[model samples]
Target chain A: MNERQRARRPGGRSARVAAEVHQAVTDLISERGYGNFTVGDVAARAGVADSSIYRRWGNLETLLSDVALTRLNAQSPMPDTGTLAGDLRTYAAQVACEITGPDGLLLVRLAVALSTNGQQGLQARDELRDERTRQLQSMLDRARERGEQAPDALGVLDHILAPMYIRVLFGIGPLTPDYVDGLVDRLL
Target chain B: MNERQRARRPGGRSARVAAEVHQAVTDLISERGYGNFTVGDVAARAGVADSSIYRRWGNLETLLSDVALTRLNAQSPMPDTGTLAGDLRTYAAQVACEITGPDGLLLVRLAVALSTNGQQGLQARDELRDERTRQLQSMLDRARERGEQAPDALGVLDHILAPMYIRVLFGIGPLTPDYVDGLVDRLL
Candidate 1:
């Protein structure tokens, strides 16, 4: 390999390990629910040493926070449909997929479970919320610049994201297309 | 003591035991979070025998369900304020108080944590949800009968209750009077 490829090797390997560890966490949460598994269990599942996990994440809560925040950041980019309604519908639909996918509810549960543990968990929760709010604000700003009326960030959160998250949290019902779009339509 | 007083003694004792046990569960959840404690922990905290708790509730999940459902049933009666908006505002405000009160988030966390364990857990989650939906339906029905325009039961759930629950779940913000009233106003 060239010098460039050689320089990239360490990061590439580190990325692979992180991906494996995250998958292990997702799997364990799906099978066992939050707070049931530990760092050792995650390491065993991911084929890594316990020290690797602790060294990387400090503890299980930190590791869980990393997994959740990483996933949140990795979610689909902000939709920029011509109109605010189109943008919201697309945005809502994307979120609906994330929360309903194979590991969706598990991560959502992890975030909720983490929020009540202590100061660190609370900080993680706040970080997740701030990231989401920032993303939503960007889209809202774009709409405002385009001269279309845009709802406030919290309004989008309360009307669109809150309903969807609550539904998943309680396993109330499916986040159908009509239901997702209906939230945006009502907000508008 | 009179015969009636003597007859009520056993029932009163039974009620007292149940209350203490429920409070123990709530306290443990707040202190330790779900799945971190057990039946023995609750019994010790409640000053009751483990056998008594097992005999009455069958298991921890059932006991948690009892605490949540009982609290849900014990909330204020449906508001009849001569208008749909008034009733909704009153109802939302009551829920905001319930969820933000001392043991409110703990019970909600219990309900959420219970929902993921197994079939029994799923049933407990469903029952908690159904009870809330039934109560909302009653209010909506009253509004309809009085010829006032009322949002559908699910609409209220999606718009009002969902937002409040989500907020508490994440410790997002306080449910101020204006915010509570704003949810009702938006629904109307």
Candidate 2:
């Protein structure tokens, strides 16, 4: 292999294995809950050998952290709809889709639960959260640039974002499409 | 026995047992997680008779629902500190304390998981959530009566309340005293 190709080969294979194992971890947690399994169980489920998991991770908590962080870090690309209401509606709809569904909802709760176990556990989660905030801020700034008097990030999240999450997390109420549109209208 | 005295006795004893079992469920779930246990395990941990738990709750899911709803229903009296700022500061501090502890945090996630399992499970939780809304609405109304320009229930909860929960649930970022004050100030 050429020098560049040789350098890239190991990473490509390991990335595939890591992706498989990480997806396995979340799927198992969502489907089966995280209390019952062993590393061997995860290895079997991921189709990676136990020795490889050991060689790569060596620690259970580290492996779990990697899974948790990887899931949290996967931000979908935001759709640009040009108009303020349309942009927010798209954003809200996307978010609603995200924190719902059986597995999706469970994973969000699991992410929260695991992240709060300690300060160290919270650090990477915090960074991911900041990234989300930045995304929101950028969206709002674009609205402002377009002459829309958009609400501040904290305000929008508190009034608009948090309610949706609370509803999903607790089954406390509904988060219908009309509701999303109304929030965007009010905020705009 | 007199009617009043006779009416109260069974309830008093049963009430105590119910509390014990409910506490036991949360404690066990927090300590050992929600899987790999039975009514007997909860009973053993609670030091109550297994027959009592079975007699009262009927099935494991019912017992789980009762615990989830009970915690949701147990809202502390919100302090009226004569101004919106003081009132919210007190409120926010209490919430931060409630959702941050090991058991408190676990119970929030447990509430979400159990509530979403079926329609019957969500009913009691939905009621409790409404009561919380009413409580916040009442607080807002009183603020209006006192001529403080407070946001309505929907606004307060959506913008003001949800952020606190978001922070607690995901370890997204810090929910410090200063942060709470900022949220309250922004909302006001």
Candidate 3:
């Protein structure tokens, strides 16, 4: 292996442990939709010592929050199509696919439900929003600079996002690509 | 006093009982949201016999759903204005006030969280939606007949309602009169 490659090698033993736990969180949430899984369940599935998780996250809810935060922070960068209409349609469609699906929707609901119970919940939710806000603001700013969107389009992302979430809340499903296209067209 | 009035008086006893229970449900939900109040608690607050509640509504979730449905069904008729825009604005604003408040948002979350548990949650949510669909269809039909809205504009009510819920989800309170006005104006 090259010297540079060797430098990045080995996230090491703790890293392996963390990676396993992360996969377990995703697996369990995907299976149960977030309302029922417990920390001990994650511990057994990850094959990590229960003490390892307890030392790091303290509880199931915080660990879930960490997993969610990590996913959001590591989300793929927004697509950059040439036109504002194309960019927004692509972005909105991606979001519809993400949140309308059973697993993705549960993650968000978990965050909201968690926040109602305590401070860690609020912290995780706020952190996620901060990360998202930065991502959204950057996308909109680019649109404005390209003269593709109106100057005032800066704050309009939430308006577009609102409908997709409503769709999830009411259990409206499979959010057809055509219907999401309509939402983009209308909001634009 | 009068014979016709005396004939309507027999509803006095049972109707009073129903009204008391309804008020108790509202009070408890408003006080602590809907995740925790018990059937016994509701009975005590209603000052009606526990047997009466059990005879009418088998469970707390079902009883809560019934209360929400009755209130929604008994809601005042939509306002009529000279223009479709005016009518929509007035109607949308009214809905904004109703759901954006603390109690309204909790009621919705309760249905969603309950749905995680079993069938009663789904039934309650479905009943609320059916009533809303009927109401929205009628209003949109009137607008279409007047040529204020296109025939296809029928399904757009959800898009309009979506933002208000998002606002409530994040605890963004007082969904300002102006903000809701902006939503209607933009969607239209």
Displacement of the residue B48 alpha carbon in candidate 1, Å: 5.2
Question: Every model's DockQ, to 2 decimals?
Answer: 0.52, 0.53, 0.36
Best model per lDDT: 1
For DockQ, the strongest prediction is 2
State each candidate's clash count.
0, 4, 0
Summarize candidate 2's per-residue lDDT along A14-133 as a digit string, tens digits: 778888888788777766664446688889999989988887877454577667555544534555789767778888887777666555564455555456446644654555566667
Q: DockQ for model 3? A: 0.36
Q: How would you encode candidate 3's per-residue C-alpha lDDT over A139-162 as one tens digit per residue?
A: 778888887654233244445677
Q: Ten-residue segment with the worst summed lDDT in candidate 3 chain A?
A: A149-158
TM-score, candidate number 1? 0.83
Question: How well is each residue in B1-188 modelled by candidate 3, as lDDT tens digits?
Answer: 87546534756766687789989988997676566678889999988778888876877777887787787655534667866677677776777777754455554566565655467776666666667667767777787778675433334545556767665665455678887787677667
Once fitted onto the true fold, the runs of candidate 3 whose alpha carbons sit more than 4 angstroms away are: A1-10, A20-63, A72-77, A81-83, A118-120, A144-147, A150-156, B1-11, B27-61, B70-77, B144-147, B150-156, B171-174
Off by over 4 Å in 1: A1-11, A36-62, A73-75, B1-11, B38-59, B75-77
C-alpha positional error of residue B163 in candidate 2 after TM-score superposition, expressed in Å: 0.4
| Cα-based lDDT for every prediction | 0.81, 0.69, 0.68
